[model samples]
Target: MAKITYIEFTGEEHVLDLEIGTSIMQGAVDNSVQGITADCGGACSCATCHVYVEPEWLNKLGDKSEMEEILLEEVCQPQANSRLSCQLKVSADLDGMIVRLPESQF
Candidate 1:
């Protein structure tokens, strides 16, 4: 299992202990973490699961694919750390990952 932290724009934090191989979007939805709408259900079609990965944890996560990069461009208030939560798979190596939600998503 891996522990992930999801912090909202208003500073609300949802700390979750989730199984490996699950998407970050699933973790948030399973735990009822606010702001991760995940309208595409991990299909990578919608950008509603958008989040900003904490700078320190960026390297621990996987690199964005060509399609993810293109999808991210369509989200609101994109940032250098912005990513689609559904694209992030949980792994033992990603324990303690932290992500921030954009105001527009909440």
Candidate 2:
């Protein structure tokens, strides 16, 4: 399992131990983390699960898919680190990953 940290825009942090292969969105939703709404579940159709991967860990995460890249453009406060949590799968390589939520999902 990977231990991931989710930081809300307000600065609150939720840390969780997520099983391998689970999407980051699923881990947040299952733990009731305050930031991710996951409006489309893990389907990648919604940008509600938008998050900013910490710069230090960005390279560890593979490049975003075309669909993820397109949806990210529509998220609030898109940035160089912006990504859809639904597109990130948990794994040993991602342990200690930290992601910051946008001020708003809309």
Candidate 3:
């Protein structure tokens, strides 16, 4: 299983021990961590699950798909590391990954 770590700006951290095959959004919603709305459910149609993935871990994840890239452009605060969590899947290499939640979603 790959473990993903989520860190809020407030310093709160949630460590999700997810099955290697599940989507990052699914893990967050299943774990009930705040900041992940996943309104579109893992379809990559909504930007509510926007997250800033630490640069160090970016290479670990594959390139962003066209659909996820376009949706990320609509996020309120798009950073160089901004990514739609729904598009990322849990993997053994993603253990200890830290993602920051955006300030606004709606």
Candidate 4:
């Protein structure tokens, strides 16, 4: 398992223990984290799962796919480090990553 932290726009934080193959969106939904809506269920079609990845952990998450890139453009207040949580797969290499939600999501 990996430890992932999800911080909401209101400063609420939820730390989750995620299975290695799970998507970050799934982790949030499974743990009841409020910010990630995951409306498309990790299909890479919806942007509701947007999260701003901490700068230091950006490289560890790997590159986004073409579909994810296109969908990200539709999210509100997307940033340089913004990502779709459903697109991020948990693994040993990302043991302690941190992500923040945008206000629009809440």
Point to the candidate with the largest TM-score.
2
Q: What is the TM-score of each candidate against the true structure?
A: 0.95, 0.97, 0.95, 0.96
> Tens digit of lDDT per residue, candidate 1, span 1-106?
9999999889999889999999999999999888889987999888899999989888888789988999999999999999999999999988999999999863
lDDT of 3 by residue, 16-101 (tens): 78999798889989998888999999888988999999999999998999998899889997989999999998888998898988
1-106: candidate 2 lDDT, tens digit per residue? 9999999989999989999999999999999998899999889998999999999999888889999988988987899999999999998999999999989999
Q: What overall lDDT goes with each candidate model? A: 0.91, 0.93, 0.88, 0.90
Summing lDDT over every window of 10 consecutive residues in candidate 3, give the lowest-scoring window.
2-11
TM-score of 3: 0.95
lDDT of 2 at 9: 89
Model 2 TM-score is: 0.97
**How do these models rank on lDDT, best leading?**
2, 1, 4, 3
Better model by lDDT: candidate 2 vs candidate 3? 2
